[model samples]
Target: MTTSTQPQAQAKRDEHTQPQAQLAVFDMAGTTIDERDEVYRVLRESAEREGARFSDEEFQKWMGTEKHWAIRNLLTIGGVEATDELVDKAFAWFRDELARTYTANPPSPMPRIEESFAALRAAGIRVGLTTGFSRDIADLILESMGWTVGGGEECTIDVSVCGDEIPSGRPAPDMINKVMEITGVDDPAAVISVGDTEVDVESAQAAGAFSVGVLTGHLTKEAFAAKNADAVLELAADVVNLPQVAAQ
Candidate 1:
């Protein structure tokens, strides 16, 4: 064998010895969990409080953007003066509405989410979450779903990187990078980031991580295709049984 072939063979051997430390990052609301339209739904309901009305088209366009960006755009397009307090108040209303909705209709684990996690764990791979939802909200969702990080009778997620945890949010690579920092994983090629939006794909691509897109969320499969998504599939429910995921 040639000198160059040795490293490739060794790498393959190493992969079999270890679970490959394949870190997987998931987006919360809409991606791995329910609560689709939660943002816009809350925005529309909070219109009266903001003294404005949000256009459905415009709101849909801002799907993957952070809450602040969406709120800023809503105010700007509505010709309303932007103030720190006003922005804060608007988001507060959205959160309040979200909390109410969640209390009444808490999100259940996405189809196959538990199965996918179990498979990854069984394989010794680590799983983490990256979501636009605030850490506070993330905590609530996890608690409701009974997710534990280490291991248990149920499931354990390795880590979570939330929007508020870092200065920059999705469409930025910071969240994924933070997951890397927390997990101590260095190679992006070894990591697979999954989500249901362009922002998630962009973040993964920016971080040089393999990206998986899903049609389970707000964005269509074609939308993910347009972003040059690495792999497109059904919801997390389908993740566990896939040959690709199974091989991973």
Candidate 2:
């Protein structure tokens, strides 16, 4: 099932004070790399291959979450048993198909994302990337985009936390916490988590960080607002224009 903690978390964030952003953690896939939703398309195909079927709404609810978990949930929704063996088989299929699709039509960086990253770093704010993909797939996408991960001067991102590296994925605070730990950012209030889904907003709130939803992916502005995101932007690259990010 799709998990969320929007109601209680939104109220908590409202009462809490937000500090100026020092570390910006971003989600990959639709938020950073414009992969054209191939991941979701492959996910559906894999599920159907296993005799399971679901609607677009069901598919969307799993967006921004770990692929394995998403597959298991989607299988259950389609009246499948969701056995570990079945889930693993489907997951393997998803990985191979997505990789093949990406190879066929390489993904590109979101518009002006490089400039946005540079601007944030120039303002003394560190940048990070968090993703629901495993390390191998995440590395592939990053390599294709010509981005390097590390704290060195030549690196494009300060840190990268993948789904496999964390204990849990979105709506859980683990990945964001990992980013904070790696970036040496102590206060969650000083971190901004940006992505293109409601789970992204829920995850940020769960981590006590500011959440900025972007329309660069699938969700609409109204959908983001309903999730109680701290702010919403027209594009991922437009994050640099946010008052909190700009002030940093």
RMSD of each: 7.7, 3.2
| Error at 240, model 2, angstroms | 0.9
Clashes of each: 3, 0
Model 2 lDDT per residue over 1-248, tens place = 12232313664243134667799999998898899989888888878888888888888898998888888999999879999999999999999889888888989998999989888888889999999898889988988888998777677989999888877888787888888888889888888899998788888888878889999888888898788888888887888877777665
Off by over 4 Å in 1: 1-21, 47-49, 52-55, 151-155, 240-244
* Clashes (candidate 1): 3
The lDDT for every candidate, in the order shown, is 0.70, 0.84
Best model per lDDT:
2
Which candidate ranks first by TM-score, i.e. highest?
2
Model 2 spans with C-alpha error above 4 angstroms? 1-8, 12-17
Per-residue lDDT over 117-161 for candidate 1, one digit per residue giving the tens place of the 0 to 100 score: 877867766788887777777788888888876534355688887
CA shift of 247, model 2, Å: 1.9
